[model samples]
Target: MTHIELSVLIPAHNEAGNLPALLDEIALALSGITPVITPVINYEVLVMDDGSSDDTWSLLVQRAQHDKHLRPLRHSHSAGQSTSVWQAAQLARGTWLATLDGDGQNDPADIPALMQAAIDEDAVLVGGHRVVRQDTKLKLLSSRIANNIRRRLLDDDSPDSGCGIKVIRRDAFLSLPYFDHMHRFLPALIHAQGGKCLARPVNHRERGTGQSHYGLGNRLWVGIVDLMGVMWLKRRSRLPALVTGIEDSELLRGESEAVTQAHEESVAAHVVSSRMEALKG
Candidate 1:
């Protein structure tokens, strides 16, 4: 199979109304991107239906018939966003993966630019930072507080850790440890794994069809425990040493000389045996 350069993964639960338009926007966005690795933009779209009771699955199936790039995945029950992204990462066949929210608030047009940023910066992860958030004042306040607390505790240096749109290398993503709500700490986790994380300004839009899935209950309150766990992981994590070159040693040189002498002796013996056999013949 031909390798895909990029995999666009969207995790949606009860986002039936938002996905149709989102998918279309993704297709349009991907069409214009000119990747450095491939002549044409080789990409696939994997949308995970996290056990939505709505018509999400059916819509995906219908869209797949028309769009070959669209590949829909599902869970029997509603798994959280982290699990959905985790499962999709395992299945995605791409050098890099681009993720977006299913609620249509994350602009698909920004995906190409982010992907380019990842390549240009040689970053394993390029996170989207929403400069002008189009959310309620309450939502904005809650998110600001959470981000500040997370930045101080985790020391991830991310301006917007909760932003959903991001481009990540598939291999780097798979190396990180997984847990519930891990998606929110991707920049920190990626940094912990010794991968470069860049935050780029992205366009954030207001929700179009359905209400926001997250609130103070699920967004802020539940995240407290997850935040503590991530902090522990960060403290315990260590980056790998930068290896310059293999060191030459006297013992290795001696071993190499011995192997060379043994091979020469074996060839000399073979030549003698061949001469003897020819004389006999």
Candidate 2:
């Protein structure tokens, strides 16, 4: 039996105080979940320190030394959460990628359930819907408005794209276009790529340390901008037309070349289409 590798990427800013607890929870969760009909299920926990001003990097490094499966990747400058996730995706060696916030709001115990949902549904992206968010009223209101607007505009059925506890296929994630706030649109992006998305309820907790990074107004503003960008991308996307043919060797080679060429052309066309859509917007 082939072993499946899972990569858990945690994007951190100044989350030193919360890292220890999050790591411990992850360790416990991974230990509890046994693989079915497989000799092994390899997993790695990656903490991407996004130019943290605190001791987050130091703590992550210390943890990595003790645990071979724990990896610490640091960014020289303060990139946003989406970039941190993208960078982690580039370094990840797992077939499946699960993203969680380092601020300790997301429960690591729910990760196993998310992974199971991915397997059961054959879903490319499985997002977490926070059953009880432990955020301030202002933040919650802002998120609610943003999520509603996003769902209406993007037609993505996900209830909470901001939950920050999502499991996705590594290849599907890497294929999406990288943007500053792309993390909030994973389900829509996955759907754009002809992939399936499922939303599962998960637990949300309050932050143990540090203040909220963005205020309600800023969160709403940024989300609006990103929503427009995603809508444009969705409108311009085009899927290839299906074709059927004989299984001759020469025909297969020719067909393969044609398919490759078509894919390249499609990508180029999408780029052009995206630019045009942006201009129209």
Candidate 3:
């Protein structure tokens, strides 16, 4: 099988009514962009049904049968959105991964733009900033408060962390430590690994079906705790060392002691230089 260039993972929870429309929208969005592969742009859409009580899994199965690009994975029990995303990433064969909520609030049309931004910035993570969030007043307020607190604490500069539409490199994402609500800390996490993160404005829409799974109180209270966890992670992050020198080895045991001493001196000098530069910085 050919490797997919992009894997779009949508985590669904009781979203049977929204799956068909979401799939159609994604099809339309992907139709315009040329994939990394020629003739057939190698792309796949994986919908993870997180133990939805509704007919969401059935709908996904039906879609997958007709559409080769559509693949469905299911959890036996309800897993949070972060867990669902992690599960999809494990199954994905794409070099790049795009994620969106399955509630139909995130517009698929914005996906191409996010992909473009990722390319332009050479970013490992490209987050969507909702231009006009079509959510309830309470939801908007809660998100604003959360974003503000997160920006201040993490200094990630992302305007809208809650936006569900995002594009990220698979390897970079996989390298980051996983947590329950890691999705909300992508910008900070990516930056901690020396990866660039760019945020671009995208379209957001009101839900056409089923009520939102999140609410203001849960977001404000639960999100505060998650933010604190992210801060602790940031403090513990450290930059990797770049090895500058190696000691030469003599193959012959009969080699003069002077030769070994010279090599050892050279290695010590290199280590001292590296330490000096690090101290200077």
Task: Please report the candidate that would top lDDT against the real structure.
Answer: 1
Q: Output the better candidate (1/2) by lDDT.
A: 1
What is the clash count for each candidate, in the order shown?
0, 0, 0
lDDT of 1 by residue, 1-281 (tens): 55577888899999999998999888878785543334468788989888899999999989899898988888777767987787777677777799999999999888888888889888888999999999988789888888888988888799999999999988778777667688999998888777789999999999978888888888887776678777766665575522223333221111120113344345346545643543343
Reference-based TM-score of each model: 0.82, 0.83, 0.82
User: Of 2 and 3, which scores higher on TM-score?
Assistant: 2
lDDT of 2 by residue, 77-181 (tens): 566788678767766767788999998989988888888888888888899999788989999899999999998988888889888999997777877876667
Q: In candidate 3, which residue ranges exceed 4 Å CA deviation?
A: 33-40, 239-281
Candidate 3's TM-score = 0.82
lDDT of each: 0.79, 0.78, 0.77
Better of 1 and 3 by TM-score: 1
